[model samples]
Target chain A: MTYRIDNLQYANWSEKIFRQMREGGVDAVHVTISYHENFRETVLNFEQWNRWFEQFPDLIFHGQWGSDVRKARETGRTAIFFGFQNPSPIEDDIDLVEILHKLGARFMQLTYNNQSLLATGCYEADDSGITRMGKQVIKEMNRVGLVIDMSHSADRSTIEAAEISERPITITHANLHSWQPALRNKRDDVVRAVTENGGMMGFSMYPHHLKDKSNCTVESFCEMIARAAETFGAEHFGLGSDLCQDQPDSIVEWMRVGRWSKEIDYGEGSAAAPGFPPQPDWFKDNRDFGNIENGLRKIGFSESETAGIMGNNWLRFYDENFGPQQI
Target chain B: MTYRIDNLQYANWSEKIFRQMREGGVDAVHVTISYHENFRETVLNFEQWNRWFEQFPDLIFHGQWGSDVRKARETGRTAIFFGFQNPSPIEDDIDLVEILHKLGARFMQLTYNNQSLLATGCYEADDSGITRMGKQVIKEMNRVGLVIDMSHSADRSTIEAAEISERPITITHANLHSWQPALRNKRDDVVRAVTENGGMMGFSMYPHHLKDKSNCTVESFCEMIARAAETFGAEHFGLGSDLCQDQPDSIVEWMRVGRWSKEIDYGEGSAAAPGFPPQPDWFKDNRDFGNIENGLRKIGFSESETAGIMGNNWLRFYDENFGPQQI
Candidate 1:
């Protein structure tokens, strides 16, 4: 029952390397859509998205990027859906929402830690609770099937979105503030709001992402995850594990700076956060929770709970909200 | 003993109007420097401000904008100095704190009504709580001399600003929310915070702005004023009628829309407000309590309290916060 899912991927990922996903035990890749169409030429166009489907065949892609996942499905590409780390690409265009959703965007984080035209991002200098546009976006998202993600947004903006969003939101990737206390982490209210609203919460394994990465272990991640599950009731929670298995340090730097766009940085000289111990398998070792099974097992999740933590809970969520179109 | 003062206006307006004021029976004006302005404006924009001295020679202008007021006073303009609103308008630009303090802009309002880059505005969609930016704004405003204004901001933003602000903020132009549940009005906590913080509260003659304007008479205005004064200590309350005279219906509609460029509304479309029939001079009728003077009488206020409500209370506030600078 513990269906595994890794919620995101970067632009430079390769088809040949991900062939082991079947062995990696990941059931679906919840891929985010990029505003930039030229994603490393590999994921450059619909052709790459189609190629991934042809190559993996059984692999399911939950798209956040702009891909006709269903169209790909018609061409035998497994369900590649769309997601957005920030709602900016949608801009003020709510109608584009239906077009994107129909084109297959499944998840959206309201902001990316800075002020957008819609709301203050989590990392922004000012945390204006939410903007008029943010409110409108949430309502529209509910009408469409775009899931709200609070992973990188500020607590105030996230909480506001949670209260306003009719459909439960999905925290695509976050840690517990109690465990990590990083800006990227979620507060108890945020998790409770999301889960209480019948949404999903995900835990990432960026050690630098955890509080004391110096002492961070899988146990810490689990403790954070389990605590939130206990607080909001376990059924509403799951894992995203923002597992950037092979993303380079440059990409990491790009992520850190690019998310905010504003040049004002307190950590101008500091390296990218929660840096990994230089393991031989640096990419897989530092970024992911673990290499598949060992990751959850080391995190001390019971098999059934681990199942829920992996993809089962997400599958159930997808089924309840958008799966089967039974509604 | 009933001294009249306007709690809001730019710094030099006093000198310009002071000559006319002695004729009109006006004593002083609570001159506000916009919190959003740069320090250079306060410090360098002295020539025009100095012109006020020659014009109104005897009229006193309370400097609520920032530090430039001190310099203005030093150069011979009598200043009752303080910051009028909490938000520095510099927002997360905390560095501007000392710079503006050096310029003399002190008083601030936590927010306007919708959420700002710093805090929630009075008319926000939800009254969640003090945001991180709001909390920071309060601390900085207090550290400096920014007075927090809660007249047109959100309830939660007001509450948070009150609790968090080091110095007490005044409800400079608010009616009792108990009388009418408009966003511009304040609650009992407002009374407590201002009084407790040793700040002042003021009543407004904004009949059109009151919650139940249709039912509003001078009696109702008096009731609201008295309730707030009593709830807080009378000593901590004052009169800031927020009276804007000589504007056209278009301007009224502009205020109604709550925006300079955008025209949204202040809520409650149909209500009896002070209008042309009784007009500005309408309150002159009832000597016991019907007239503005009578309204004070109906409240059973002593001459001192009457004077304070009439305007002296605000005078005391300005004189207290900014007067010590006078050699």
Candidate 2:
């Protein structure tokens, strides 16, 4: 065994997509359950997922541990893991870190696209790193095994989070800015800071983070991963497709505006194309994991290294980080 | 051994009160953490209690089960159990019944002193009984072991709750309306419906529920209990106190008019006296449990019966009702 894991996705979930995950042999996917919802609203989302798990028990199950990936393989089902793309689920309460973790949230980004109570987002001009509550929440998250995700955070905040977290944090879905020059993508220094602290970088398949938007080739994407592997070791890379499949353009507005702004914040998109950008043809949905795997092998990566990039690295990271830290 | 459990209290909690509980040999207390707060505000209240438990570990600890009373006795500390006087902490979501229970809420009233989403309160003009959501919430509460408390609900609602709930519900702090006709007290049919269905009724120490307000005698109170024992068995009764010790009048206003009213709603108090009523001399604080014990004995009760009313009855109830139902 090697495992196929897409560590990030916010799809318009349906039976069709769940079937696609099974067809793709995707063992586990870290699905974003909340973007800007508050605690009660996020719980409603969990309740909705609970209904989904009940309705489609044979197709999918709620994943909590790394072993669940192996269990999913044996059972012939896809394991869906929960995460938050924003810290809004916790509001201002530090104790909710433990509460939400107990409710099966494994990953939470400190910010989304603006200044949050915890940390500054990449879109903010002044990145104040982490706030006072941020440090306390990080300690609590470390204690409770809620993995810190700085995927949408500023460079300073992302760097500080890697330094502050006792457990290895993650940038769950983004590419290198050195490759695409997108604001959402991490710079070389930011990626190095995270990987140096034993964290993982998940290559995103979202068009905005690609080399040439939706026109980017699999060759270019694989080459970027090859460069990252040479710079930061192969064990620190995995796929976090950020696959927002089948979601409407209005959903993108909710993700970007989200009750915080009265004006539109066309994050990564211009005024004309102000919606979720189209995915590159090579990587469109869950079934495209094979294309990326073959591309990695074609880019001069050995079998073991390709296995690590495909999913085993995330499985190892999950085994080590998704529980209370040993004293 | 007999346990000294006060099943209801909403005090201005401090080291002084905790020490007083120890002086009275009290083992456990189900403290009201929220009166009318929504889910988030209620969590803030729990956080405050968390701080208190941290600051005074030797004096108090968070209690979740009947066994914790024994643990408290062994450790020589008071085990503080959490409760909500209204269903506001759960908002309109039925799933929060389990969420709040996991956060250590042992009891929750269906209503306060006004009409709630679940049921009609005592002060309401008509008793419409339990709502459709109330039936679902009762089942959820039963499954999760969060006891339904109808101490502030109207007579019809109380009776309906007892009929609907699968597990034993509680009137955590109230008295018999037959003895003293107060709005907040339970009527004969209401008390009978609860106790006959294996529920517990905790006698209130609030002056408004007494025969002569603040001038009520211990002998009179004990005689009322003796009659109640004959009517509804000695095993179904215990002390709740309803002791709002050291709370200011402003706190009472918040309880009675928590974002629900524009004008003042004094609840049990009148316009002339809109604050917490004075406690009788016989039972002013936790240090006075001995007084009630003596009075019960003087009123022709046996030692075991006196112990049962003092706390043993509640401990037995806790043992049976504070865990997931046996399916």
Candidate 3:
């Protein structure tokens, strides 16, 4: 059965957003539960999401395993799989990898636009690559089925993480640097390495990662995916959409520079617009997922390939990777 | 002008211990503030210590710099320097290294009788050496004046840490494995490597690490120290004592196992004991430090050598190492 999954989103979650997820027929979504939150703060976020799930049972439910996507499909509700765009939730404890996994966190990035205990983020001047804790955490994450997401990690760290991870890791929300040359985007070598190792790359719809920013056409974006699929296997890519819908500019500040710096880090932005750039008109929210689906078909992906890009590939990946290794 | 400092201790901190330190003329002490606690929990431990400092300013005050040791001597109080037996206090965040230093953590063990994010403990069957995060943490610790203590770490990891650290690291407790051949003791090679790198070795009086356990003689202990001094420079050796005065057996469970294990870890202890063994009759408490002093003198040490071994050497080390590198 076909399933539509947005591999990443950090919306100002509300009943309205939950309804929009249902409206979008989004069977599953990997939601960013923590940006800079530590273990306790992130647990608080989880508790908040718990309340949302209870209040909006008809529209959403917690997704612990990949099979939950099917559960969401059967129940006509969206499955919310928890993820972290940064490793802050686990802090410095490698043991927390299993604990966070048990708490329903499925994906965690090693770094988020800075040097973390694990890896160098995309914004750091020097990319030290996977650190001592990073390597250990990667092992623990792999052991416990917490997919290593290198969305905002620096080039060398990201590549090293891909190589170091035992399981296929992911970039939950990012684009190809070859298409737009953005700092948050992955270069061809990184893309090649990730896909070569059976890892997934969820192309980002975040404006900063786009070529024309907020004005990027759906046609052009889909064309980029088509090209990416040609360069990297089509099976290894999906939509992450980094859709930070309805979040205030303050949240963006928290995202780009969470407690790490006193000065505001206008990452991938200038002083003129140090906030979330306006998302492209065709992809404003979860409800607009159809725009990319149709655009993918128009960009000449086979129907099966489009379905895979839309979500089936992710579902397959989840089926294979989102549980303790059988061995 | 000589000062007396116990380079490590995790006593059941109390007025009794403070008075005993005063009676014994201990100018300062490096106290273990955390074993398995996370940053927040460790902060709570710091808060507890803060309360102690507030309640007994005449007996003890928080020590941040080597100068504080001098201040303690002049003010007739024991300066309490904070340390962690395990890296759990920092959890997984590299940034916390600086934060912990600012909070007055002067010494941090890379590992404590098990594998940590930093290094392999002596208890582990295989020693992988200083980890990725361990290397980074060593550098950060060196930069921030947090001495890296590898007292409970495996041979390779301890040697690697000493080699990697830009500043001198330490083994704040534990005698020579050549003397006792215990799990927590350091080998001759490890000792050679540490002292060669200008690091200090604070000999432990913990019964489990002693040559004859609770029956070990002061003469034998000091003789071992003399041999260690001859082998690895008398200037690099001092007393840590590792005094756990007044602590209950339950506290031993917390020290050895913490939350990392569900079952009790009989680290350096057999199932027959599984607790803090009785102190040797000659060194039952802080007051017994004099016994060691006299013993060192009887072991054919020069007056200055004995004074240095008792504490002057550690004081000099503190002055040289307890700050950021002077560029």
Candidate 4:
């Protein structure tokens, strides 16, 4: 049976959202656990999730390996896979790569929206590629099972990570820049590097990354996927959505500024609208996942190709990458 | 120039010990910072040491590499190297091997007189060579600069660690069982395995490991080293006085029992005499290091050989083993 897996989401998690996931048949979701928190703070976030797992056993559970996705499907529940949108959770320590992996973190982005110790962010004025610590950390990450996510890293850093990492790295959430020229959207060259290296690209449904913001329809999004499929195989694509449903403006401010910046960062937006951009109506929440699936099929993707783009591809990638490297 | 280095000591550190080390011309000392503390607790211990380093800038400082020992000599101070007598600091996580090393922990015993997650301690009746985690942790430790110390581990675990580690592992503090047959002492076979595999064995000067406990003479202790030198090669031997000076009896109880056991464990002695044994007269404190030097000369070793046993051998071993492996 084809399973639905959202490779990325940062929802204001609650029973309502989890129920919506069940309604949409979301077998698994890679949820953002750490945005800019440090190691200790990230641990607190994990502890909170632990409480959630204990309380909401029927709706969702922690996912450590790819097999958990299948288990979630069998149990008619969603498997919540933890991920970090920024490497700040590890601070400057390379060893935390493995420690955080053991703590159930499956994915970590090299940078969020500014330069980090590991790599330069997409918003940085100058891209210095990967730093000295980044190379060692990449090796450590490879040794363990933590998947490197380069969603918000600069062009040079993202490409460098893709090349340096022995295993396939991922861009868990971002649209193709060629289709929508947003700072957060990855360029065609970056997409090619990721796909050619057997890595993944999860197309985002966040309004900022869409061609016409909130007005973009399912036809336009699916057509873009069709165009992307010709260049970078459909097997390499999946939905991330970058969904942040029902979250207040304050949460968006926290995600963008974190603790690193004193001044406000109007990322991908002007001072007038600094919070999270509204998601397209076609895919506003987890319940809308089926809309994209139908849109992909209508755009002339084969049945198997549409299945792969929906969630089967992510499951296959997870099976291949979500464990310690074979000795 | 010859430098004086003590391979082991766990004093209730104060200005007095620093002054005594200066008087003894001690250039470097490996100091135990943890017994059964977990990672967070160990970090607190490290923070405490950091305060000490700042307070006594002229007397002691943290030593990360062998060069720091030389620097200590040049500055007329002691380089205090950090170690753990148990693997508790990492708390079953292999990743913390590099993190603790980065935090200045150069040595970590796989076990401490009881079974740990990694290995069987000396006190365990059945010795399982090395656990699955033990092997991976050893590989990680070898990759980083953290020395795999099996000083308090079971014979099988100790020997297996020496054989498995790519780098020269060390038994930083212990005595030959053939000389004293103490519970904590290593048998001849264990010593041979270590020395044959290019590892270092620092003979313990703790009274319990001595032939006649506190009554053992300097002559007898030096004679034991002389015989060990003939068997295991003098280049592999050095001093690791398991000195626990000025620490109260309560601390000894904490070391032996920790949180693992509520029932009191006498360790090297019976319940009637459970506390730490008194040191032999000739080697009571850091200032008494010269007595061992003289005793080695009295026991018919060359001047260079005597120097090696006293500290030079450890200095050489440190120079070779204290950094990340050269690729």
Candidate 5:
């Protein structure tokens, strides 16, 4: 069975988003929950949790809390695994790791994209690896079932987290840094380590992170598939679009601030990527990548190769941690 | 028989604080819950919650949550509250007022020191009153049994929120902008509105906001307190020493960016005021004032006036909201 999972979740985890995900052809999703620093807006969708569980019985939800997401499970949703974006929330407490695991986080990324208490993000000018606390978090994440995902993590941190983790780690959703050259992308070294370590890699459908959005097309994404397959192997590649279909400006503003705790000029009234404007509303699946299935079709792969890319790879990865889903 | 509350929660609200409050002759405190966009940090004090419940078994914590806190009886933490800093977290959800009241919100401020969804903040260069959302939030806060607070709210929005609310409003923790003429202080018209609406004013101990942090002692803070009292009433005045103790550089960075979500330039590696290039910590309390209690003594008050300045005025304000202490 093909299992398409949406990887990153920041400002888009809401009731409004759940309905849209159904419309956009998402079968499963990896949800990240945290005591985020910016809690002025909605933090946990647990407010509407019952309604969501009742409405979408079949849709699988992989939750990333901290340690034991399985125990926090409500009957209807998918088994949630726990994870972390930053180790700051746990502060100085190591025992909280197990406590958080009990809360239902299955997969976690170490640093959010910069220097945190645990590890250095990919964007930092210096590639100082994981901090001592980061090492502890990794050791603890390993002790528990939380899988390591280095998506927006810095190179040094990712490699360090991968090296320290007992099981393999994942580049949950990202284009190669070699491909896009932005701080948001992962380096080739990370890609190599992931494949060698028997970890998984999920290519994201975020256009800005893809190499040259203006020149991007279905053919480009397919070429990426071939390149990633050759680099990461077919068994390790999956589809997890970091897509936000109906999210708005406030979300982008949250991203803009949450990207870094300090203030720096992010450019004029708003900032833009190479082919995208400062506005998230302006974002469209421009490269012929349609509703998840159409996106695979556009990539032009045979049935077997396509199936593995669509969901099989992620399923294998998730099964490694939480056991495979029962029909 | 005496009940007193200081309108500030920025002080860690720790066991040490409670001990200090009892020593400093304080009875209750109007603890500010939200000013920055950090919702996660505000509540769920997992480690210390029980201790707070045990100590002072009768203390009141007036938060900025937007409803009268009722869980006080269980926690011994009388949460006589209302939103003192309207962060617009109510967002578009006007119904959330009643919902949050059920969750224990009472007092609702129209805005913080800068702009929010509903109104411009006190520091903003331009003064536009209430936005449509601000009006709606004010109305809802009023309709749902929330008192209105206009501490750091913009002049225009403060007036509008005060004028619109069915109940008395508060300007909890402020200064006479006419005296110091600052971004953080309040304008005269907004002050008048608070008095007209049968509310209270809580003066702060922030230094850069005073007329010459050098030229003043507790003497300065009291002058501002007296000026506000003259304009309003002694009954409406209290102490809110927005006194932030143990607030490290991380929090200072948060406050700097909080002005407009963009950290405005203060100086070379300096952010002015709180971020003022490493001069000295506690410069606001000033060398002459010694500390909080000594500083109160410096204000040159009679015994009763000193008692009110210390915290008694806020205790009366708390009873006004949290149903005259259970005793």
Candidate 6:
């Protein structure tokens, strides 16, 4: 049973997208529920999702465990797993790690794009690694089955997270810097540190992380995945997409600045293009997943390996890591 | 088996207090875990209690249901039930009613001596009764089994809450206005509205609510209880000591001021006595519960009625109200 999953997406969600997921045969998606919202604000986000689940029960449902993926497949619906791009949802409270997990958040990044209370973000000049609270939060997150995601963290912090987490840590959405040279992309050593600790990496489809930005070809994307698989094993790779479908440029501004700056931060975009860049034509939305599948096959991935890259690896990882660790 | 439950207390809790509860044969306590804290700060308070529960497992455990009282009695430990003295923990979000309940909150007052989003507090000059959000929150609270508490609310709002709530609400800690006429005390009509709707009132031992402040006699307190029982029935009454044992004046100041006021508005105290008033000699601490038991017995109350007032009545209320409502 090949299960298609996108481990990261922050779409301006609608029924159209839900239908597109079904059209794409995507069984589950780990969706960004919050970026810089505090605990109360994040809860309001969860409440919004609850309303969505109720309003569109036949199209989507809340996904808490791997079994929910199987259930979604059986029911012909998409399972929406919750995640955060920053530790801001937990605020400064380490105990909120468990609380947020109980509220159905599966992934939490220690930093977004700046120095947080827990760790240094990739944009920071100095890489201070993890702070005292970061270590404590990591242990609590491990205990409570909230996966540590260092997708936007500094090198030292990401490496330290991979080592400090008793459970495997993930870089849920990023490519290799060796391939794209993007600041948001992971370095070879960071990827190796995570993958060697049995963690997974989800290749990003966001244009900034690609070789030629919006003009990057499907062949090139497939070749990049092939290279990552060759280096880090296919089981450690999956799709994240980072799809921001239908979201306006103001959303991008919010993502980049997020009350952290009074002035705008361009992030990966330049001053002239300070907004979400267009996706490569071939991978436009959920329905374009098939294009990548064919690209993988044309690039000579075996059927099982393609299945693993598509979703099976993440499903397995979810099964193992989304619950309290066995004593 | 008679259960000894204090339905309200906000003590400066310590090992000493827990030991004193055991010495007094107290099985359960609905303790105020927050006064004006927002959701995240309230969670920090919960975490503090969690640490205490861990540190003194033999002395007390987290109580979520009436059965915990029985468990406490059998194990010779006290069960600490969590409550909030204000609606601030929910912070204008109706969904947090269930979230806080899942986190073990059993009681939440609609207001705390100032106008709130939910209702008018005693100190507020205008009584607008239940707000639009308050009505929705009441239904959600009923569905989730977080009891509506109107202890610090004004007359119109308290009456409105009793009418709006499908489940029985509570005046967790206050005395009768007819007995002492304090601003915080419930009027006879307010008490009738709650009691007639099957709600319970926990008689307070706070000096300001007593007949003669700190010098009020045990006999007078017991006689007042007798009069209340005669008027509202014994089953609707229990003890809520309002015990601020060992709390410093600063804590009392915080309780009264919170972050709402720039100026000191000494609630239940005058400018000359802008702090917690001294408890009557007869009821100074948890260890003094025995004195109330003796006074109740000496006031010509039957054993069953005395037992009910001591704790059995609250035990019954907990059994009926501490979980999700029946479909």
C-alpha root-mean-square deviation, each candidate:
10.0, 19.2, 6.3, 14.9, 14.6, 18.6
Q: Which stretches of candidate 2 lie over 4 Å from their true place?
A: B1-327
> In terms of docking quality, how is candidate 1 classified?
incorrect
Q: Which has the higher DockQ value, candidate number 1 or candidate number 5?
A: 1
> lDDT per prediction?
0.56, 0.89, 0.86, 0.86, 0.55, 0.89
TM-score of 6: 0.53
Question: For candidate 4 chain A, which ten residues in a row score worst on lDDT?
Answer: A257-266
Considering TM-score, which of the candidate structures 4 and 6 is the better prediction for this target?
4
Candidate number of the best TM-score = 3
For residue B232, give model 5's deviation from the true position in Å. 55
Residue-level lDDT tens digits of model 1 in A113-218: 5554356677655566667646766766677677777777777778878788777777877778877777787778877777787888776655546656535655
Q: C-alpha displacement of A5 in model 4, angstroms?
A: 28
lDDT by residue for model 2 (A218-239), tens: 9999999999999999999999
DockQ score for model 2: 0.01
Stretches off by above 4 angstroms in model 5 are A9-20, A23-25, A38-51, A55-84, A259-302, A323-327, B1-327
Candidate 4 lDDT over residue span A205-252, tens digit each:
989999999899999999999999998888999888889999988898
Name the 10 consecutive residues with the lowest summed lDDT in model 5 chain B.
B280-289
> Please, what are the lDDT tens digits per residue for candidate 4 over residues B1-327?
667889999999999988999999999999999997878989999999999999999999999888898899889899999999988787635568888999999999988876555667787655656654566678788878898888888898888888888898888888889889988888999988888978898988888889999999999989999999998899998988999999998998988766543256678777888888888999889999999888999999998898888788888888887788888
lDDT of each residue in A23-138, candidate 3, tens digit only: 99999999999888888999999999999888888999999877899999999999999999888887655678899999999999888776666777776655657754566678
Q: Compared with the true structure, what per-residue lDDT tens digits does model 6 show for residues B15-70?
A: 99999999989999999988978888899999999999999999999999999999
Task: Give the higher-DockQ candidate: 5 or 6.
Answer: 5
Kindly give the stretch of ten consecutive residues in candidate 1 chain A with the minimal lDDT sum. A35-44
The fraction of reference interface contacts (C-alpha pairs within 8 A across chains A and B) present in each candidate is 0.02, 0.00, 0.02, 0.00, 0.00, 0.00
Every model: iRMSD: 7.6, 18.4, 8.0, 20.0, 16.5, 17.6
Q: B18 in model 4: Cα distance from truth in Å? A: 0.5
DockQ of candidate 4 is 0.02
Clashes of each: 52, 0, 8, 0, 34, 0
lDDT, model 5, position B305:
63
lDDT of 6 at B165: 93
What is the C-alpha lDDT profile of model 6 across A46-80, one tens digit per residue? 99999999999998999999999999999999999
lDDT for each residue of candidate 1 in B1-327, tens digit (9 for 90 to 100): 465554553322433344444443444445444433333444544335545545554555535432433333354443444443434235335556655656555456655544554566665565545654455556665665556677767766666676776666777767677888765777776667667877777666555456455346776677766776666767776655554444344444433332212323434343453222123444321111225656777679888877776666766666555422222
